[model samples]
Target: MNELLTKLSECIEFGKINMASPYPPNMKGQEGADEITRKALEEGVNPQDILSLGLMPGMERIGVKFRENKVFVPQVLMSAKAMSTAMLHLKPHFLSGAAKQKGTFIIGTVLGDLHDIGKNLVGMMVEGNGYKVIDLGTDVNSEKFIDAAKENPDAVIGLSALLTTTMVNMEKIARDIKEAVPGTLVTIGGAPVNNDFCARIGADHYSPDPQGVVEFLNTKFA
Candidate 1:
């Protein structure tokens, strides 16, 4: 059983989607995350254990690799794809209350920014780490963010911006969220964002990488 779980983890870490997927070359023709995860469930392995011991470990390794620049966006996106495929099997368990998520996370690319690659990566990473991610997509505004936050009062908010011009909008959104929903945690990121900007904008946190966002949520909720 443990071996099966380990295989599942390897599938995610190496971006193996299924036996049919061949992108990773060496992992080709092997049962991948999609297959292994379903097999684990068939054998009666607890869903939560599959998530914690299998999926999370794989995602953590990939996250660290991404942060260290050992892997690039293409690799990370492949891993996210594998993870998301496996998650389809687990979603029912979550809905049935057999598994619980860490918390809700609302993420978006701030207004004036049409970039989505960075925002999508963060959403995938957060979701892989057990948070229920609600992606607002690109070109998001202050009102949309505040509305989502109000709907999910306990949720954390993440803002992404790839351009210096659009990054400034994070301040407005962050401030508005805080004003409309005091004590809400707002995290800002993207190429033009940093801890200094985060402070200046009155946002709660800033992280250059997706793993940092995961760690922040874990620490905040733990």
Candidate 2:
């Protein structure tokens, strides 16, 4: 069972989506995350174990690799796809209360930002790390974020901006959320955002990469 879990983690880390996926030349035709996760479940492995041992480790490895420039966006996206394939099998267990999540995360690409790649990457990374992510898609305004936070009171909010112009929107949204809902932690990220910007805008944190965001969430929840 441990062997299968290890193999499942390898499948995710290597971007093997299924037996037929051909992106990673060396891993061709091997049982990928999609198949291995189902097999592990059928073999009576606990869903939480598969999540923590198989999925999270793989994602962490890729996240670090991404931070180190060992891989790029296309590769990371493929790995995330592989991880999502495995997650589909575990999600029901999560919803049924048989498997536990670390916490809820509400995320958005603040209003005026149409770009979603960064937002999606962060969402997938957060989800892969065992947090339930509520992605309020691109051009998301403060009201939408507040509404989602109200529904999931303990959820941490992540605001992303790809453009310098959009960064101001993030500051506004953060202010609105804090004023309306005290104690709500707002984290910001983007190419243009930094710790100084975060502090100036009253945001709780700023991470340049998805892994940094995941680490912040882990510390906050822990």
Best by lDDT: 2
Instruction: Report the Cα lDDT for residue 12, model 1.
Output: 83
Every candidate's lDDT: 0.91, 0.92
Query: Can you give the TM-score per candidate against the true fold?
Result: 0.97, 0.97
The alpha-carbon deviation from the true structure for residue 2 of candidate 2, after best TM-score superposition, in angstroms, is: 0.7
Worst 10 residues of 1 by lDDT: 165-174
Candidate 1 total steric clashes:
0
Compared with the true structure, what per-residue lDDT tens digits does model 1 show for residues 1-222? 499889988888889998999979998788999999999999999999889888988888999999999999999888999999999999999999888888999999999999998889999999988889999999999999999999998999999999898866878888899999998999989998888999999999999999999999999877
Residue-level lDDT for 167 in candidate 2: 84
Candidate 2 per-residue C-alpha lDDT over 116-200 given as tens digits, one digit per residue, 9 for 90 to 100: 8998999988998889999999999999999998999989999999999988899999999998888999999988899999999
In candidate 2, the residue pairs with backbone N, CA or C atoms under 3 Å apart (3 or more residues apart, or in different chains) clash, namely none
